[model samples]
Target chain A: MSAEAPPAEETIASPRPVRGSLPRRLVGRPELGAVVGAVAVFVFFSVVADAFLQWSSFSTVLYASSTIGIMAVPVALLMIGGEFDLSTGVLVTSSALISSMFSYQMTANVWVGVGVSLLATLAIGFFNGYLLVRTNLPSFIITLGTFLILQGCNLGFTKLISDTVSTKSISDMEGFPSARKVFASHLTIGDVEVQITVLWWFALIALATWILLRTRAGNWIFAVGGAKEAARAVGVPVERTKIGLYLGVALAAWISGQHLLFNYDVVQSGEGVGNELLYIIAAVIGGCLLTGGYGSAVGAAVGAFIFGMTNKGIVYAQWGADWFKFFLGAMLLLATLLNWWVRKRAEESK
Target chain B: MSTSRTSKASQTSPASRKALVALSDISKYYGNVKALDGVSLEVHAGEITCVLGDNGAGKSTLIKIVAGLHQHDGGTFAIEGEETRLGSPREALDRGIATVYQDLAVVPLMPVWRNFFLGSEIHKGRGPLRRLDVEEMRTTTHRELLRMGIDLRDVDQPIGTLSGGQRQCVAIARAVHFGAKVLILDEPTAALGVKQSGVVLKYVAAARDAGLGVVLITHNPHHAYLVGDRFVLLKRGAMAGSHAKDGIALEELTRQMAGGSELEQLSHELARTPAPDLSGGVAKG
Candidate 1:
């Protein structure tokens, strides 16, 4: 039966019959068990640890989260676009080594070093995406190739430059002044100040969120990842979008490099290995499906938060840090299974 | 001459009725294969224009052209009497043309509202400063789905949570909300059951009643008979014929679609074939 239709003068606030909205559903989703898990861990540690609840502790978790969190946002987007970047971890390590060489060994200006690092990382992204689109091979193998190559480069190049696998000090290097402020600087809020990467974390999240939700470009991102054929059928530039996602991921790795290199004066050639999995874990925990077609950037940020909390929380609980991998693996499994159950319920409820 | 002929053949004459879309002489090709040759059809306001074809009959090619997924080699596509070339789905969208794809155009894991506003999101404020008007979209999505006779308890649930028929409904409602003047459905009822097909067909009429033109592509003549205002049959990449609702019979369309006499001949031949020759005994018919 056709109902009485609303007049043209109707207000935007008209009563709707949709039962629960997306935001409301997201808040109540059983799949968001990781978020709950994150909170529980936070509260549990805060109550027991001496300074865990203080702002000082907040800075550490958030600071560390900066690198991984920044990486997680784009990784989540790439995953949503139906691809993966296993090279992202080694890509970061390569950038850090590249930057250290210029600033410490080569005696180049710090800004130049940072610029070269970012450009190189972005280039790696371009190369990965280009190869993926051209060859039509699964990104797993393509990025794995990049991962191994970058890992080897990071090791071989660092040793070649300094005859060692590490750099002692970019601190005494000339012209690190302006370069350090933008990336490695700290912002103090009362007594609980930490690294400036926290700022980068927020900025990147905000930017990624806006692009994912606001722009027309963002719509294409979801469409391409969700169903590449359908997206191509609709005339979306699937290849371009895919390539850009990989590039975005590479840029994220570059940012992570900046955070890591700045926080520690000594740069190790092999530092950020296996970090690709951590970023993926953060994204998956945040609600990105590996199979593509669906994800949330903000959710990924929260997922990174979950990781940050649990990582520090375990230590504050006076537990061995080595147990970190066990907790992470368990959470990943639990969250994924829970997410599957929620999807089933949502589908079944309809 | 062809233009006028096709115009006259379509069920609702543009002069006599409101047509959402009138595609006259749409042709397409893939390599050397002439997929669609001079296909012309009109989808009238609130009426289903069913395009039926057998395997390799260019049905997919035609839908792609009409849906703005593929560029036509030659054609004049007019929406609301304004001649336009649908260069892309975005361009088609500018002319109020939208498509509800077969495998669901909706992002399965996304919320219903997000899926509804996938490419065309509702924003408020000036350009660059505009943010998604979430409340507006959510409420509008709810209200529109309900208007389409869909009763959903939550707008936030993933579209994958919905049934095939429900997903079709959501896609329809989405097309309508995006101000679609013409909605092209690509095999929407292909995977649905009888009851589910009915649900989809009902919405096709509803969309038409709401002043939109709908192109329903399917191989099922029965489904076409239920809601079609015009029927276009394709066989081997050529337009078999176009028939109006008043002039066509459902059985005849089905017979033609299934190659009625061919099936009958095959059955008769099967019956006449020796059942089993061995064992020294001929099986009596």
Candidate 2:
């Protein structure tokens, strides 16, 4: 029922709105650091490596980025909502393993296996979220538990069902051709062949950005992340918002899983063991606060792009790939410091 | 008592404004300890009913019960004269009872517009494509703050930069904007400086003038004396006194706030003996 009491007579305060200048708006963006970092990295690489500017190499970078971007987008949103999913790394492998093993064991159509895997993967996500909410445990601890459990299940279940650590080839299975075309197919743009994952990655990023910027749900994510008690005092559904975020991570994992299985025609149960950190690193580099509350999906996509450049740029420059992790570590630290400076500027400039 | 607790649901005019919220003989127990005993309060539209008490005097417990954060063990809490139980803060909010806590009212890192609409954000469009109406919110936030007599440098600034009083005012303005019928402020001026406290008292008066039933809980009788129309004093989980503005004087209100007879006993214990000849001797030297 609506309030039966008398309504407020008039507005309380009547301050006029100050118009936002272009520069003020630019500085207010959480992604400004990531954008500047991306440009700087792009310029540095272009000058250092001759092949970095080529269309073919650029397409390769996009492809590599897409793989990580797909997961990073949802993970970024999750982080903004004040949580993480450590199991996401093995969860991706588990998704592909389930589809492949189920198909091979049952000798059924690959599509049927894919459907079953989808349901199973989503259940894992639901469990992680439910356990977290019910126990009031940190998402880090809760998801780490799920990660270890899923990691074990993936290996043990695959060995028992397939007699090997990897699933049998699904190339000749029914529905394999269509699934492959949908997920693993290549597109020729100019002289470069681009993976279908790139399209999926772009679509996911656009969807995530729309949710983060526009929806009431996006508002709830920020509220819940920024300060849950304050958000709760205002009647925001804090628990439900957090649970939904975990589910988003699961759905992204499913997409990435489908891509992995279709691309290789086989699934390794041990794959995707340590990719969760890469997703988190990309989101952080993209401007998501590790503490939660402030971030953007567009920033996360740029973060993945940086990862792609660094990964491919080194090989193109003929540098040893051994130093890749060292570079990744340094970039994460620098980006974090840069993001902190940008945030301070935004808060102080006003 | 019968005349004071009129049914609010049928209230019609400013002349005979009914009590919007009434808690009669409310008592709460924590296991064996009495947190609140036989406490009664009445909040009427266009008036501030100040609940004055010192630390551990059940001020927070009383606010928590009225704001739906806690359920009283024994009491009849009537809203618009209808007895009801509030299960959650959301339920209380739906019934037009908004409680602004001392410090936890707003997210400091969020911008003013975002903080203004933290839980109840305004959105447009349909389904997944729906987005925040940023321009609409910004304009509304600006207008609302001005209406509350709060002039901000910018709506885009982080809320943390605002002084404590401004933050409390923003919260008060938010409650008003959302159509709060009964505003319960938990020590709004407790942590503020003299000037800041004055700023908040002005808004409290402003809120009362807008015809809200305000329940202001505080320990400072001087602050309470400024805008409070009725005063309820609590000491050690029990009502020490309750008085209308006409019936009570400022000094007596201060005496009641200091636990009345308890302070008298302490003053007797700490009374100093006379030092008669010390000043004369010093003057002779």
Candidate 3:
């Protein structure tokens, strides 16, 4: 199948010299705006809030960021594949509720509950992706439907099984300590205590970046997102790629769900009602295009970091928690505008 | 008309060798509407077969059948002397048939090297550690494009920045590097400028010179006449005429391509046409 001949020594003169200078190459990166915005936000918070620079405050910020970052990684990937999963927020709750209720009702080990929850969450993801490709509908409509259905099921199933809006505590169940160690344990790194989710978040980001830039699936994601018909014409599996993207989001949701259950020792059926928008906002702030096809995992991590800074910086500055939403909205708009401008300049320079 | 043309093609072609790709009375229908009917074409290795027609003249339908986007409703399609029905574009590529579409050949936002190895990316290592051989792919893409006379300044540039002709050439080079035995090009020059069209046509000729059987679809007769070994004229959904290179002259080909007597009638209608100045009167009012 190797049709390429060995390289010959002949060379032809190019009309233009190679012009990839450091700055020019930087300008073309999708994460350039996110990096600049993160730095700006960091400087702004450090100057405005007296405690923002403290190690304790920084660890808290990272903990907040990690929760969102875990979900943003997969959401960013799905967006790059030209789709969305609106059910992710409620899906997290559904996963936690399923695990807690199954363990309590069956008197099973927490590990078994976690395993069953994983399969159930993946099935829901598969359902969304299968319906989407089979019908060729906009992902917004399909995932929105799944979102409402999961939202309703979360509350109904929990109330029916536990006779309340939340699940019974699984803190005393077998394997609870090990599961908590994996999902919600914190470690003191030198003088600073850091949540385990931060490590999970970093690992997910690294994994996502590897898949995005160094794999065949990564190439297919960019292709399917950028030009689906062209990708299909060249033999890329468009439908399967999209489904895999949705599965990625579901897998991340399961991790986040387990963290919720283990950290709190209970599950609130309505806890994650609007968190899906937060993950998408972090991804967009990170530099992933809303239209799909062009983005980076590092950008999404930066976006989540930005969210963390704003969430904690306001409290440290003594600003009302109500102002948090307003600040987040403004940051999202500014970061997106910066990304659009940078992309335009990059294209013009080329 | 098609019977006589087939006989003439058989006589002109060498009897000792079979065609790399052969279509006989290929027909396609969309419910009740006929998209193509009774169209026959043959492609031989190291030669270019030009399919010339105007818009909506079934040129696209013919390419779709050969490219495995659609199946023919009637007649036979033979590849390397075997009658076959291809199920998908992947099947077509696996059989050494690569089709470069007009506007959908490459993803514009991707880097040139990424788009070059997009679907059939080469991977090294094993299991979870396996990854795309990015360095090898980049060098191979650069070398292959250079071989095709496209000296890119950087393969990392988004392919959208490349001129239409360069993109087409890159796509052609990719097909050749992937060992395509038959290269089907769909209106490669339709959106290009005059100079760009010339550049793309040169690469099309280069693909032919590389010992590939090329099916070139175009509306321009002069471009086809410059490189074509055989010409198939399509009108509406049927074959209007077919000719071997030596059997027909360029003027006759152009005349038939321009609708024969219908073009002559349109010229006569425009020659003495002097309408009263109704627009001038309306403006004065």
Candidate 4:
């Protein structure tokens, strides 16, 4: 049965006043601050680094952005649901390590290892969400515990299986060619070659934006993050929504891990130790709040783009690698302040 | 039990017609504490049943039982002539009972339309393509609020920007639109100004006019008397008094709600004691 009343006569005069002007409405978007920062950074790099404007260099910058953007999109979704996943960085390494070791030990098709890794990685994500809900502990603590366990396993298991700190090359195994083509292939778009990860990155951005803004689960996500008790009282299934968000993060980590393995033919045990902070930083810069319930996937993508630009721009400008962290920290503080100011203006105008 | 004579008489007279919700001698306990005890009330279609009490008078405990947040420990709770205990808020909603909590009714950061359809979102399309019907929901929210005498500047504004009375009205309209046969409101006007309270009570009346049963929990006898068809007064987890509209006067209802004899004792003690010398006390401090 329909839950709402039938439409009334259209001749009835509208009781609501006219909506705000376009610019006023634009300022209310969660991504407005990140877009502004992206534009500013683009201009600054173009002016300082002469090579930054080249199409080839821009493609390199995009490749860098795609790797981080893939993870940041889901992390932003998790943050909007009012939780954290500190285990994501090491979890990526764990996924890759599992896939490589399984394939080499079994002498099976690489696709089987890929399939197994997906299940194991998702289980870890489920474990984190289940512990958080059942224990009533903070998500930070639950995921942090998983983070340390995964980090230890990545090193310990790699050493125990291979007698080294990295996985053996699987480039010559069955199904390796097709797997590499799917995860790490390159496409020539006009004159510049682009990584397949860039395509995956854009596809994820589209999917995430749709889920955040258009689906029933999306509405529940906003509710659970905004006022969890109210959401639960009204039958929003708060626990299920949270668990689903953690699973989204794990799914993305699987894709990123597969890309790392297929691209290099070998997996490093310690490769992704601090990348979780990078993903979190990108989401926050994109306008996701630490407190939850106020962010967008597009904003996180823009945040990743800004990160990619600054990282490569420093090299093009001949700056020392040590200055990269300093620049990123400054950008984060400035973008956050701008987001706060814009949000205030939007509220006051309302 | 002494004050339940009118209720008992009325309950027998209405035996031919069942109430939408009926609670008889309902009691709840927490460990050794009697949070609520031997309370009886009935809500019928197109009627307002006002439960009046002071702080620690077990008003909240009574609401929790009917709203399905907690089950009653003793006695019977019936819905539409069937005796059953509700297990959750979802079960209550499925049975056409909707409760609007005072402080936790709406998520402040969401838009008004989103808040209107928070739990029961409308969707169209198949499988993976299924998505929220945003346009329909927005129009419906605006139309429903307008029908309730609320003219908004924009439904897209964060609900936090709305006045407290407007938020309550929005929540009431949502419950009404979702086909709630019984509406349980917990202190809807407790944190509002006099004008805002009047506005909220008007919506409560509007909901009743639309053929819904309402259980209004409040401490303000004046506000209660303005719209209540039946009054149930609570004191220390027991029924102090219960009356039909024609059986009691507003002044008596106010007196009983203000703790009856206890208020008299308090006033007598206050008058006997002299007013404090504020200037001397301040100088000593």
lDDT of 4 by residue, A1-350 (tens): 12222222332457544566899889999999999999999999899999999999999999999999999999999999999999999998898889999999999999999999999999988998889878989999998999999999999999999999999999999999999999999999997889999999999999999999999889999899999999998899999999999999999999999999999999999889889999998999999999998899999999999999999999888889789999899999999999999999988876
**What DockQ does model 3 achieve?**
0.42
Pick out the ten consecutive residues of candidate 3 chain B with the lowest summed lDDT: B1-10
- For model 2 chain B, the run of ten residues with the poorest summed lDDT: B1-10
Per-residue lDDT of model 1, residues A263-301, tens digit only? 676689988888899999988887788898677787688
Q: Note the Cα lDDT for every prediction shown.
A: 0.78, 0.87, 0.91, 0.90
Q: Could you tally the backbone clashes for each prediction?
A: 7, 11, 0, 0
Give, for candidate 3 chain A, the lowest lDDT window spanning 10 residues: A1-10
**Per-residue CA lDDT of candidate 2, range A1-350, in tens?**
11111123343333457766889778777777778878887898899999999999999999999999999999999999889889999999999998988888899999999999899989998999889889999999999999999999999988898788988998999999999998899999889889999999999998888887777788888878888899999988888998899889999999999999999988888899899999999999998988888888998999999899889988888899997898788888888898888778766766
True contacts kept of each: 0.31, 0.53, 0.57, 0.55
Q: Model 1 over residues B27-63: C-alpha lDDT tens digits?
A: 8888888888888988776566889988889988887
- Summarize candidate 3's per-residue lDDT along A1-350 as a digit string, tens digits: 01222122354555333547889899999889889999998999899999999999999999999999999999999998889889999999998888888888999999999999999999999999999999999999999999999999998888888889989988989999999999999999997999999999999999999999999999999999899999999999999999999999999999999999999999889889899999999999989988889888999999999999999999999999999999899999999999999999988987
Cα TM-score per model: 0.82, 0.92, 0.95, 0.95
The CA lDDT at A46 in model 3 is 96
| Model 3 / residue B124 / CA error / Å | 1.3
Clashing pairs for predicted structure model 1, backbone only: A19-B153, A20-B154, A21-B156, A22-B156, A226-A293, A347-B161, B46-B208
When summed lDDT is taken over every stretch of 10 residues in candidate 1 chain B, the lowest stretch is B1-10
Q: List the DockQ of the predictions in order.
A: 0.29, 0.38, 0.42, 0.41
1 against 4, candidate with superior DockQ: 4
> What is candidate 1's TM-score against the reference?
0.82
Best-to-worst lDDT order? 3, 4, 2, 1
